[model samples]
Target: SLFRILGELWPIFGGNVSKPKLTDMFYIPQKPYLTVGTLRDQVIYPQTREEYDELHDSDAGLAELFALVRCSNIVEREGGWDAVNDWIEVLSGGEKQQIAMARLIYHKPKYAIMDECTSAISIDLEGFMYVHCKKIGINLITVSHRPSLWMYHEYLLKFDGRGGWEFGPMVLPEGYQQGTA
Candidate 1:
């Protein structure tokens, strides 16, 4: 029954989505799914190529954001901002995560839902990123197993996978000393 329904719907959706004639009017609403790994794409790809070119052409603090993520050298190493169009091919996993964090910082959303966003990032850099996020007033709802992240968050939510869960103020592990500024 489901296959029959899908087979009927496929003809309708498939033609419109797979190939549209020049004059055919078709619109498909798409909801973007962005995760920690795809953050670099968010920063690199705008709604249009013109917007991306304009962003680099203009003094819109792109350099500062890159510096914030320790990616300033990437532009220089890659020959220029133009080279960043192929970030996925050129950047390392850690670098990609950094770029994603930078994108989050750039948008400055009031509340960010981050799931293991900094898993590839080093503890020192992760701390720096968290500090800046707090400084910029972006609240983080982070999902990570790393105990190093406790100092940055005010609350904790833990799921035991066996239908058990806990939520409360962040509890640091033993001998964890948050350093003074």
Candidate 2:
């Protein structure tokens, strides 16, 4: 499975090396065609030929898988490797939320359904994720009460105080339009 491949190669690709257990969160592909070292060699530059050869020789297949997983932002945080090792069992709600989002994106799904997935993240990170999704051209269905979330959405589905709903393309709030004019 893709997840298993990612799990095996994650350490080689400079991923959250401390959290070996957490590697399972990635979605594994059905067939094993690539390795961690191959991916690392393809995407990142090794300081020396010796380094590349070492990675290439060390379970090359898994190395490729890890390289792909390492591409996720959540896996590349400063001190993230140490954090995953020390706090894997005691991660905060926000950390867990971020992990789940990373797993979802690892597979590059055609469509995503996010039910308040960003509730635990700061507004800035939430905005960043939305922008990333847009750049990737992934269709998203996000559900959240935060007004700021609407800024990243192309359409809005609002539920009125009454037992009614309104659906339409998103419009800039009146305040924003007034300032521009």
Scored by TM-score, the top model is 1
| Per-candidate local distance difference test | 0.61, 0.49
Which number leads on lDDT?
1
**Per-residue accuracy of model 2 over 72-168 as CA lDDT, tens digit each:** 4433452332222433344455655554454455444555556667687677676766667666676666667777677777898777767688999
Q: What would the TM-scores of all predictions be? A: 0.68, 0.49
Worst 10 residues of 2 by lDDT: 27-36
Q: Could you tell me how far off, in angstroms, the CA of residue 10 lies in candidate 1 after the best superposition?
A: 22
Misplaced by over 4 Å in model 2 are 1-89, 161-163, 176-181
Residue-level lDDT of model 1, residues 1-181, one tens digit each, is 1122222323443433342231221111111223322223445433344665555665246678888877777667766544435455657777777767766676676666566777887788888888998898877666677777889998877778887888899878789977532
